[model samples]
Target: MKRAVIYYSLTGNTMKTAELVAERCGADLIRIDMVKPMPEGFKKQIMYGGMLATFGKKPEITGIPDNITAYDDIILGTPVWASTFAPALRTLFTKKDIGDKVSAVFTLSGSGDNTKCLKKLSKFCPNIKNSVSLSDENNGKPQDNKGLLEDFIKKISY
Candidate 1:
């Protein structure tokens, strides 16, 4: 299948997961960046970034890959914020259409539940074929979740 992994990562955890998933699936990996990037300090990340997520603010984004319609499947990757997918996803969704595509959503969290996150993803990609959540070890590093990622690959792949 022609697949693409579109993702946003603030602290590298989600980026790592995205890389592994893309390599395993032989999918194009595209990273989404907010026009105004978040603060770098830990406290600021929580204060500013978390606040945006908490309020469901979809900040402006740039570098959205073009020609996504050419891919058969789209994998949306995000880092958990306020227990849900990051707000940047909203901006992306507003810019593109995934209605006729087979898609999946994956998240990297710091021991936070992804129930709400998955629900939000469905609003954008109703036909989401699978969802995966990988927890980070508080130190901001993603825990090993190769098995979970592989299963997601199987669910989305032909």
Candidate 2:
């Protein structure tokens, strides 16, 4: 199947995971970004970003891939904030009609409670075929997660 690995990465964690997914699935890779860059400091960025996410605020975004429906499958990736997906994805969900597409989610998280985020994402994209939560202990430089990533790819690729 033709798949698109779409993601947002504030500090390269999601980007690294997206790269691995795209390479493993031989899928087209796309990155959507927040219109306003989040703060660079780790604590401040998390605090602010988590607040925005918690409040269901939709920040503006750019680099949205054209004709996302053209693909057979979509693999969405985001970093976890306050046990939820980033607010930037709120913008994507608002701007796009992805209801009918085959989708899966992969989240890079520190606390390992990405199930909440995954459930939230599934609510937004009802057709989500599978979900994977990965621990990013190295600040987005994930290690020893190839098995988990591959399993997620297999679940949705067919």
Candidate 3:
């Protein structure tokens, strides 16, 4: 099955996890780039806007890949901002045509709150088959989570 791992990262943490997931799954990887990057102090900026966006459910993604029909399965990765999925994922969900594709999600955070992001994703992609969350405290190393990611990939029967 054709698969793709797409992610949005303000810091390197989420990008690192996304790369590992793609490599383990032998799937294509796409980094969602904003036309205008967040301000220099992105962490602070995100912390402020992220809360409002999460509460309001407003995603501000400016772009997405034009052709998403090629992938049968998609894995979305993001960093937890204010205990929720990053706004970029929200934007992707609002703008993309992800109908019928098998989907899963992974989140990276200093603490554990996988359920929040997964729950939000469930609302966007109701048919999502699986999801997982990794804590940054576990050494925050991509290699450490390889086995778990590989297992998740194998479970994606699509």
The local distance difference test score of each candidate is 0.80, 0.81, 0.71
RMSD in Å for all candidates: 2.5, 2.6, 3.3
Model 3 residue 33 distance off true place after TM-score fit, in angstroms: 2.7
For model 2, what is the alpha-carbon lDDT of residue 52?
A: 95
For each candidate, give its TM-score against the true structure. 0.87, 0.88, 0.79
Positional deviation of 100 in candidate 3, in angstroms?
A: 4.2
State how far residue 11 of model 2 sits from its true place (Å): 1.2
Q: Higher lDDT: candidate 1 or 2?
A: 2
Predict model 1's lDDT versus the native.
Answer: 0.80
Query: Scored by Cα lDDT, where does model 2 land?
Result: 0.81
* Colliding residue pairs in candidate 2: none
The residue-level lDDT of candidate 1 at 9 comes to: 93
Clashing pairs in 3: none
For residues 1-158, write the lDDT of model 3, one tens digit per residue.
Answer: 78898888877888988887788788888887555556678676776657645675554565466776678788888787776777766666667777346477888876655777676667777777777777675655544455665677677534
Candidate 3 deviant stretches above 4 angstroms:
57-63, 99-102, 137-147
